[model samples]
Structures are given as structure tokens and as C-alpha cells.
Target: MKAKGRVLIIDDDAGIRDAAFQVLSREGYEVEMAGTAEEARRLVEEYEFDVILLDLKLPGVEGLELLQEIREEDPQAQVVVITAYGTVQVAVSAMKLGAADFLQKPFNPQELRLAVSRALEKKRLTLENIYLKRALAEKEGQVEFIGQSPAIRRVLEQAEMAAQTDSTVLLTGESGTGKGLLARLIHRMSPRAEGPFVAVDCGTLVPTLFESELFGHVRGAFTGATQHKIGKFELANGGTIFFDEIGNISLDIQAKLLKAVEEKEISPVGSHRLVRVDVRIIAATNKDLREEVRAGRFREDLYFRLHVISIQLPPLRERREDIPLLAEHFLKRYARKHCKPVEALSPEVLEAFLRYPWPGNVRELENTIERLVVFARKPVIGPEDLYFAGFEDQAPDLTLEEDLPLEEVEKRHVLRVLRACGGNKTLAAQKLGIDRKTLREKLKRWGVTP
Candidate 1:
């Protein structure tokens, strides 16, 4: 196989520099040469190198001093010291000064190749470590906890316990319940936090691409699959892979997923070789898997495999006490984000927020707060400033006449929300605090085409 890195050769001897350049170049390295320390320093300023070969003896500035300069310039740069056969002790000192390895004078081609290869590999790993650390720092900030409700505290406690192990976790909740954020929290608290955390949405992935996406595929697996693709599982090896909307995956996909989860190996679509992956699976679904399995749409074995640790997130309506805290937290966050002067929510707006059922949960609450912050004419947000999706003016009144029959009130409220959403049934159902199927049944009974 061809070498896959750049190498810089800094040596005073014409023959040594020429020989090193030729060997490394023929091995597919992009090689360059500098005859003196000054020339090497100039080259270093111009381009990055994976490996540097430095001869200890130079014309003016000695190789050891030049090595110190390189280290001070870029501590992560890989360097291999070159010493004369009589200067074994100097090689040791150079190694102490951060040389990846040492090469003695008059070394054979194999020694040169091996030393360069080792140094290049070391540099690659160092870069990967730096990247992973930066990613962890950045991704850690993506999920933030704002509410102090007991429900959320319980979920976080369970997450802390789950993070201590490598077992699979299943998060069940309504849409916009922040399942994705909780998945991220579990990953950040886990021992494998140093590795990548990949989230895949099963609902968005079509059936034809589901297997290839999760298990990967070799080049030419099918039409348009021109190159080998690394699957989410392989990318998340030694870390975690969160599958969202897990209930939407087909039975065939579930079977393959079960095998990979149970056996810890997945065969690429066209390749016979099964790649081993040590990934922790954290799946989330809004639907109950037990019902899915009973209905024969989901695999029973897979359900058992994933139900090891289940966390059910309570809806925003159930956790009504947290609405004010979450509302203020969102208000402040969105105010700063949008550069708005709004400092607080009006008592009227807060009352409206508390009284209204947040069918869309935290995500919707956040969106509404952002909108209110952007459009606020005063320093405080009020009911008049409050905005709900599909509601052009203010949100609908949170109360209904209690004297009406229950059925009559339910029909009128559902119809009112439906009209507010401009006849969009899904949004209407969410506003009515019911599932789409139940909404459809109500609509059918009312003799509506929708």
C-alpha cells in the first residue's frame, strides 16, 4: 500500500537528503527537502508536514535547536530525529525533546520507511484526539436543562444511572418532549463521552436506505453507491448511537438492528465481512413498542432487547407547575438571542401560558417564546404578544363555558382549534391535545371529509 502523508527531510548531506526524498516519494508521500536549518524553517512556515526527518548536525543552527523551534511553533507536529551512528546518546536526548522516533546514520530503506510510517501514524492519532476533545466541548453545550421540575429531575437521575453502564436505553415520550436532548445528556455523562454521539431518525430514513445507513455498505453495493460508506454504528464505535422515532422502523430493519445490537457485528450491504462495532444504542420513540409488537408490526425479540432501560418523559401539560420556570428561562434565552429588550413575561401572559395546554411541549414553548421576544413592542410579554402557530392574533382563551354538555364543548373546541390552524388536521390535533387518529374519528363523526 502507498504511504499516505507528507514528509519533510532536513539534512545537510546532499546524498542523505536525496536518498530520503526518493524513497519516501516512491512510497507515495509528498516529500520535500531542505539542506539547512534556515531552509527547513522557511519550508515549515509554508506547508504542514506529517513527519519531519532532522539530521542532528547542520551548517549553522544545529538540528536539536531547530527541533526545539519546531516544537515551540507547533507542539503537535511529528518529528523523527536523525543521528550519526556514534551519537546514540544524542538520539535519546532528542527523543526526550518530543521526537516521535530516532533514525541512526546509514540506516537501510526499511528503517527509514518504518520510522516515517510510525511518526505519521502518531501525528494522525494526535490530531484525532484534538478533534474529539473539541467536539465533546461543543456538543456538551447543545443540550441545556432549564426547568427545575421534579419530573425532569427524575429523568435526569435515571440518565445519570444509565450513563454509568453500557446497556441500551429507550426513551418514550410525545413529540417535542426533548427526547433528543436527553439522549445527548446520557451520552455526555457516559464513560464513552470522548467518542462521537450520532443521532439517526428512523422516520426520516426510507426503508431502502435504512439498512445501508445503519450497517453501512461497500462500494458498488447498488446503483449510485460508488464508494464505501461508513454506517452510523461504525462511526459510533466506542461511543453511542441514538435512534429516534424507533417505532417507525420496519420489521426487517428491526431484525437487522437486533442482530447488530445482540451480536455487536454488522455486515455491510455488499461485503461478506462483518465489522465489529462497540456502540451503545440509545433509542427513542413516541409510540409504545409493546402495542406495536402485539400488532405484529414490530419484532418481539427486538422489543425485548431495547426495553432493558426505559425512560418515559412526561408531557408539558402533566408537568404544569414547570410552565412558568420554563417560560421565563426561554424568555431570557430568546431575548438575548434575538437582541430583544423584553425582560419578563406579563402576569397575563404567564397565566395564559399556565392555563393553556402545551400540546407541542417544550419545543413549541421555546418557539413561541422566541416569536414573542422578536415581536414585543414593550419590555414585558403579555397575552396580546403571545403567539401560537396557526393562531394569527393571540392564543385562544384557555377556558370554555362549563355549563355546556361535555360532548358539545369537546366538538366546539376541536373545531375552533382546527379553524385556527386553517384546517391543518395534524396541527389541529396537537392544539386539541389528542392524537391524529382520535381527531380523525371525531372529524368523521362530524361528517367532515378530513
Candidate 2:
């Protein structure tokens, strides 16, 4: 069985150390002991412990000084000081140096056990608080799934079933299809809901720091690594780790990540010891891994490892039945967020939205709604508002006439294509048979802001 927690006992007395070790071991904690300050320093550097028991009167070094050093290295360290009778003053000094708690000398087995348990509880709460803050900061307060369409219901069904097991999940969909939101939902439904849910954007990770970002590194591990850093995997221990845009990662990183996903172990960038992590992997990608593997762009083994259970999120156009619901959802959300009085979309506006092909998926729809809400001039958004928001259904007249300049013809055609694409610059560029950068340059020359 896995130990309840790891504990380190640092004391000079042989009998005291043995007694504490046996007591904690009987309670299912992995225990380690250090007789001297030097040995304790080495043990602390090599392993991560949940709680530490320190003797205030070591031979070579003052116990308070050692406590300070430990706390300096790891601000979250939980150390309980052991003081002889009548040495309460010295124990109080240790507390000022960051000791978590102090145990009186001639402590019984129950006292020792209680001190360790309290220290472990404090550490657990501290870590949860830190991870919770990070999780909230990473999100923009978006709700998960909001529609009752068959396409959406099927996805929710699959997700709910997947959440019951610890299997790896691969979420495949077009950009902005709520893959991240679905991942969060699965995490909340899983048994590890109390644990952290860490999301890593594989597409945005710097190649040079990718390994360190996922597995962490010790101090002095690199030129700028001034202090010990925890990685995403370690932070997500006992929870879920969501890798967004997994297809964008290189083959090299795929290879490095394979071992971690397969064995639940990671070796930090500069450490030789492999740390075990209990994380559920949920990877999202806009690309088909099968095609990537056939083209030799992705590793076959890694793809198989991550494809244990696949869930494909339907695009917005495929679930047109849910458009009204989604539009209203975003409308109310952004309306209240931007303090706009907009309450409804006109009939013509809703018709235009249904007729339009949402190439950018739900994300594009959300951005469009937010823009409209921010610039709304009345309680109900009308068809006229769509024109200003760039979702206008009417196409510009482009009849060729004599004496028209070539630049004028090109500009009108580009603008027409831009409007057809719902102001999605990337999609507009593709439709115009040009790169986004070139398209933007042309728009700038034409006195238009892209």
C-alpha cells in the first residue's frame, strides 16, 4: 500500500529516533532518520518529506539555525521542533524561525504521532490553497457545456463515463470547441476533484524550457534556475493534467512525455531521482494524430499511449440546433459582464447567425457576442448591429465597371471575403489564397484596420 505520507526524523538520540520511527511506521508513513545535521542536510536535499521532526540541541549546529536553513530552502516546509523540559524558551525561538510546531521532551508516542499529523494537515491545506489560486487565475469564468443538442449530449455522456476511470483521455476538436472546459468538467466529476487541475498549453511552450515546465528543476539546475521550482505534473499530483493543443508539440517532447504518461514518473530537468506522480492525463488537439503518425510527424507509440479513450467534440456548425441556446448564453454572460442592457437578438440577427458557417467554432461565436455586447447601443441587438460587428449577411456589390483600378477591385474582393468569414482574419486569409501577414499588409495599405 502507498504510505500515508513521508516523514523525516532528525534527532541525535538513538532511542528517540527509533521510537518515533516505529510509531509513524505503524501508522503507514514512510519514515527516514538522520543522526547528524550533515546527514539531515543531505536527506533534505535528496527527498521531499511531508513532515520533519528536529532536535533543538544538535551537536555541531544549533537546531534553530538548521530550521532556518530548511525553511529558507522550502518556505512550505513543516518542521516540528523537539525540546527538553524547561527549554520552552528555545522552542519558541525555533517557531520564530519557521518551525511548524514543537514537542516537549520525554514526549510519549501519542504526542509524537499527534505532532506529525498536525504538521501534515497544515502542509496539505497550504498546497491546496496555492493550487486553487492558480486554477482560478488560469480560467476566465466560462461555464462548461451549455446545450442540449444530441451532439452535445453524446459528448457529455462520453465524458461522464470517462471520468469514472483513471484512463488517459484525448479530446479532439476544432479550435474553440470547449475542449478545455470539458477537461475541467471531467476533473470535477472524477474522484480526485479536490486535487489540482493543471492545464498546460503545449502549443505555446518554449522549446528550450518545455522539459523544465512539465517536470520542474532544482536550484542551480541551469543558469537562471536560482531556486527550486515545481513542475505542472508535480502540482497536479493526484488530479488531472490537461495538455491543450497537444498536436503542436514537437516529436522530441512527445518522446520525453511518453515515459511520464506510461510509468507515472518524471525526472526533473536536473535531478537524477525519478518522482512519482498520480495524475490523469487529458490531452486536446485540433489535428488528427493518426494522420500525424502516418506522416512521420508524431510518434506512433506516444499517440497510442495518449489515445486510451478518445472524445471528439462536435463543431458548432454540426450542432446548429444549439445555436440559439449558445447565443443566448453568451449574450447574457457578456451583457452582465460588460454592463450592457442588451437582452435579446433580433429575428434577422438570429437568422443570419444560423445561415453563417462558424469556421472558428464556439470560440469565434463567443468573441463575436462579447464584441457586440461591449458596443451595444440598445436593449435588443438588431440586424443593423451585425453589420458593425462584422457578421453582416449582405455582401458588398462588386460589379466590374469600366475605369476601375486593379487595386480597387482587389480591395473590394478582399473585404467581401473578410465579411463572409465573420471577421476571422486567419480564415479570411485562407479563403483569399494568401497568408495572414500578407492579407494584413494589404488591408493596411487599403486604409482598413485588420
Candidate 3:
């Protein structure tokens, strides 16, 4: 295997430095050693390393102080503390200060190698996540709103306008219509954009842990509550709190949440003092809260409080015009992510995109593009490269039914086949058992442009 990464060892003890150097070098790393923090700082200035292993009991510029200096120089740097068994507290402190890992003194060679490898892997993943986030931000302008239908355009307009407001916003949409993305856009564009935007999926939180997570808990509040904790609401005090799938939360939790929203204050589970906070709440649900309210499944008062401003996203079927744009965006993203050279989508592939009534919306489009990018052999994704075999059973109503007009049914079937194939036309015609030229004429007559 190729060399993984570089490692820097800073230790006052010559024996420990030599041992670390040998272990790390054997594990396919370019290893560097320093006898003091001053020397380590000089080496760091000269070159970047994937991991830094520092001894806490150094003679000069003791470990924690040097760790602070290293952080001040490069906040992204991964530093692992080397502590004695008795100095375990110091090691834990180092971890709180952003140290990647700790190695107790007199550790086995295998343990040292594993710790170094884990630290390097963590650093690598962190850098990769940062890069992915940057790329996602750059691509945001390409397909910010992923549909072309008038209904979708109206929804986009409402979303853009709602993003400018500080009032509580409610997003109602089908399960896969990209409600979460709209919520993120709202937070990103709002006045509190610089502040933290916390997202909590209410559907996933356990009933018992809900209050402590939302309103926080004082130390000794419950059996496992050993330390004071700041909850999601406090974390988003000056920013935005996104309550995803709010319809799934229980009535008991809703009552507590309602009080927090109305009073702008939250009392920790074990505390009498209420903490005042300013937070913008953004709630999302696939279920209609109006029906939920009448059914007594959701709080009526809380629904009105959250519905101060509302935006509804249209399904992908309503935005067929946006399919090509969304497909291209996802294609480019997945191609770059997987390091593939795949280029444009074929005409048939484009047709397939425009025909499918995407029940899963933009997410399904993205997944299909990623799948094609990974499996397609040609530089240009063709009709044959697009796959839609399973969608027939999965989407029964979307398949051409016997009651529909033959011409209209043919048009719908062709589009559905093409979309399932990622807009590939040749394969769509083959699936339809018609000539490519005939398919082209039918598409033209149907006013379907690839």
C-alpha cells in the first residue's frame, strides 16, 4: 500500500521519540521528531503533518500550553497527547482542547500504531467533509430550486420571500420534496446567518430524552445526568432551530415546546430558573397539520404559532421542466465526487428525466445520478446506462394504465421510461419496441424537448 500520511512526534525523552519514530515509520508514515515544543513549532512552520504526538511532561513549554499554541497556528491540525498513567486527567483536558487521541505512557507498539492511524484517518475525514461542504455551497447556485413547473416556481418564490423573514416558518410538503434544503436556505439567507443553525429531527428523538435534549438538564437531573448540558434550543438561541418532521412529536413534548415558544424561556429539567432565549423556529412536516390538529394528534395552538409564515414545496411531477437542470447538477456533483470523467446526459436520458413522476423528488434524482455516474462505462451517459426496471412495480399509478387514451398513455409511458433511464431515448424506444425516429417524432408531437 502507498504511504498513508506524515506524523510528527514531540517528546523530551530520547527513548520515547525513537520508539514512536520507528513504530510510525513502520506503518507507512513519514515520521519527524522534536525534543521540545520550540523545536516542534519550528518543524510545524516548516512542513505540515497529518498527526502530531506530543508528550505532556516536556521540560520546556509544557504540553497543554504548546497544544494551545499549535491550535492558534493551525486550528485544523490534529494533536494527540502522550500522557503518563497518573496524568490521565491532563490527557482528558487535552481532548477537550481538541486533541484527537491520547496514548498512555509505556503503551504497546501496536496500540501506538493504531492510535496514530485512527488520528490520521479522523483528520483525513474532517478535511474531506470540509471540502464536500465547500463544493456543495458552490453548487447551490446551479440548482437552488430543482423544478421548472409553475407550481414549483411559485413555491420557490414563496421560499425565497419566507427566507427573508424572522417570523416562525412552517414548511409543508410531501416526504421527498426537499423541505430540509429550503429550511437550510432560509437559515443561510436570514439575518441570523452568521449564528448557529441547529436542526433536530423530532421523529428520531426518544420520548424520554426529548425534554432534556430540547430544554437542557441541570447536573444530577436524572440517573445518567452527571453534567450540566446545553440543549438544542439554547444552542440556537440567537440563530435558527429547525424541527424536522414535527408531526411525529408527542403531545406531552408539544406542550413543553409550546411553553418555550410562547415564553421565550426554557427551564432545565432539574432547575427552577428559566433561561431566556431568542430563537427563530422553522418547522417542517409531510403531514398536514390542519388534519393533524382536527384529529388531535398535533397541538392546534402550537401549529398556529409555528405557521406565522408558511411555504409549501411542489412534488417533482409538478416541476418536469426542472428535471434536466437537476439531473445535470447531480451528474456533475456525483461525477466529481467519484472522480469520474462522465460528461453530458444523452437525449433519451433527458427524456426519461422529464417523463418520470418523481415521488421521491430531488433526492431520488440525485441518487439516480450518483448511481449512473458510478456504473456508467461511457464518458457520456447514454440511454442504456439509465435503469428503471424496479420503478414499474414501485410506481404502479405512474405506469401507463389501460383506461388512459392510447396517445396520452404512450406519451406518459415514454416519459416514465426515459426518466427511469435518466433521459436516455434509444433505450426508451427499445423498451417501447418502437423505432428511434418514430420515438423522436412522437416526442416532438408531444412537445417533449430533451
Candidate 4:
């Protein structure tokens, strides 16, 4: 889809405003014009523009002062400063005030187009990065992991301990068990919390482009290497780099990564000079890295480096007592997001959640609750909304052994309930309308516990 963007032009001279309007409008932007800094400030108060062409010399108010006002109002607005031949120093000062680019008058149409395009592209990328970071933050905070269960308490203590160290950490967990969330928590609690926290999913990167993206490349490094670029290591210098699914990288890339980690420096492709960086590494994987090392799929030396502080996140099924707390958390979040008034879950729904064995772990439960909140016709979520699919074939031993057909249904339900509770068996049993002892017997018989 083509992105819709608005452009604001501010110039005292009528001729300059008209020329800018014509050029920007022709480039598919919705254009707005202002003759003075006062008019521009009024327009800015009423609306937001993707890019603003600001004249350095205004009639009364200076351009640099207006630039400061615009920045205070909307920091994300991209401003391009216009300057005359003798006023280059003013344009340089404007750049310090957050001007995205500068155009010297009288400028050609092609130069104007190029500067506008570059500024808008930069603004778009910045907005996208902000959106992704906000989404990741929401996901990380949704599951609080509160529990008194021995297994869960131990995991929390280990997490706290890991947060204090600068050594590389390796988090192993089943899919949806919140490995990414834990990585973020560790970074937030560390000494480098004020620095950047960059997370990358190694599985999503193509092998051909992986090297340039991770360590960067100099100009002319490859066919499309039009300019020198700073890679993730440079961007995340003096901070932490969370490598999600690190096992997905190829052996060639792994060796390069090991050298960078060990030497604390990176040499961009096509450049002999090395750039020194101080970055803490946190690696996570769902697969068994030791097996990969033994099979020669992963390097033994790299495996040892990443496993300095090892942590294994327990799956939802293993810590069934925490479900109700998690479910309530999800319910409140989804309600706020969807503008819903749903206040609680029905008894039957809570029972089903506690009985279900959540093969997909915490993420699946969060998704299920969000779905329930969005589609629920009533104020409370009930058992009818619970549907567990795709697990029928794999766990026949567990499902078929139960006399009740709803046993599989109940298993799905109970697991969801426990996850909602953050795996607290007493609270889960209470939510399930059963006593703690009865719940314990059922868990023992069903081979599920917290």
C-alpha cells in the first residue's frame, strides 16, 4: 500500500511557497502552505505533517527559534531548512535543532525532490522502529511470572541473578514460553539499562544478507553497497544484543560472530580497519545446542561462549499453577485495547483453562484470551469459547486414556486456567471449583503439576 504523507511549506516569499507547493504536490504529497512563522505555528498546532520545508529567514520570528518550537511540540516531525549562499552557518545551526536536511537557494527541482525523499524515508523508518519497540514492550510485560511454586520461584531467582552479570546468557525454552520477554527483562535490570537493547530473530535473516546486517559493510562491498553502513553491533554498542533463535544461523555466520564476541571488535566487509565495541550478548534457542554441537551443526567453542549463564524457561504445562493470573492479566489488557467491558471469566471457562495442557505455552494462552475478548458476545468469557485444535494426534496417549470426551477439552481448559493463574495450583484449583487436594490428585493422575 502507498503511504499517505502530508507536507508543510513555510516561507515569507509568495514565489518560494508556490514553487514548493507545486513540486511537493507533484510528488504525491498533500501540501499545506504558510506565509509567516505565526501562521506555521498555528497550522502545526492544528495538524501534524510528515515533512516541513522551513525557510531560514522569516519576517519577524527567526527560523531557528521556530524550529525549536516545532521540535518541542512534535519531536518526530521532519524539518528541512532552506538557506541562502551567505547563510550556510545558520543552516548548520538548524541541523543541530533537528533539521533533517538543508536546501540552498536557489535550488533545482531535482535537488529538492532528493532531499525530501531522503528525509521522509528516514522519518518512516524511525516511526516503524518506535512501533516495534512498543509492541515488544507490551508483550514482555503481559506475563508477570508471579508464583510461589518451588520450580517457578527457583526460575525467578535465577533470572534475578542473571540480571546482575555482564556474562553472555543462553535462555533455552519451548516455543511460546517467553524467552524473548526474559531477555528483555535481563537487559532492563542490568548496568547497561540506559543503553540500547537490540533484539534480532536470526531465523528470519537470509544467509546472503546476514553478514552485512550483523557486522555491516563498507561502500562497494557488494553490488548494492552504495554507501558505508553501520551494522547492528555498532548500533548496539555499549548495550546488549539479544539473539533470538541463535541456533538458526549457519556455521559460517556463527564463526564470524564468535570472532567478534571474543575480540570485542568488528571489521566491516571490504574494510581492513576494525571498529571496537563493548556489547553484552544474550542468546536464546528452543533447540538443544549440545546436540547440535555433537552433530557438528553448531560450533563447540561458540556453544560454550553462549552458555556462560544458562536458563531454561518452564513451559505452561510444567508450571500449570500460573494460568489464572496470566488469564486475568490478558483479559484486562485486551479489554483496554478493544474497548470492551468484559470483567471476568465464567466458572466453566476457568475450569477448562485449568484442565487444558497448553502445548503452545504462555503465548498461546495470551492469543486465546485476546481472541476471547475480541469475539465474546457477553461480559464474561465462558467454556464455549475454548477450542483446542492441532494437539489431537500428538497426545493420543493422554486424551484417549480419559473416559470423558471432554477430557481433552478439560485438559485444554485446565491448562489455560493454570497459565492465567501464573501456575499457582491453589488459585487454579479455586478457579476450577475444586479443593487443593482434589486438584493435586487430578494433577498426579494426569501427569501434570506445577
- List runs of model 4 lying over 4 Å from the truth: 1-148, 387-450
lDDT winner among the candidates? 2
Candidate 1 residue lDDT tens string, 141-237:
5577666789988988999999999999999998778898999989989999987788887866779999998877766789998766667786676
lDDT of 2 by residue, 1-450 (tens): 978888889999999999999999999999999999999988776666779898888898987889987775555559998868537678678878888998988989999889999999998788777778787788657446888999999999999999999999999987678898999999989998878889998866798899999988877789999887778898898789999988878888888899899888887777664566789999998888999999998999999999999999998878988999999999999998888888999887788778655655687778778877877899999978877865563333323565866566567767777978889998886654344655675788789984
By lDDT rank, best first, the candidates go: 2, 1, 4, 3
lDDT of 3 by residue, 340-360 (tens): 998988897787677665545
RMSD of each: 12.6, 6.4, 17.3, 16.4
Each candidate: how many clashes? 0, 0, 13, 36
Per-model TM-score, in order, reads 0.65, 0.83, 0.57, 0.59
In terms of TM-score, the best-performing candidate is 2
Model 1: how far residue 1 lies from native, Å: 30
Q: Which stretches of candidate 3 lie over 4 Å from their true place?
A: 1-143, 388-399, 402-450
Q: What is the overall TM-score of model 1 with all chains considered together?
A: 0.65
| Ranking of predictions according to TM-score | 2, 1, 4, 3
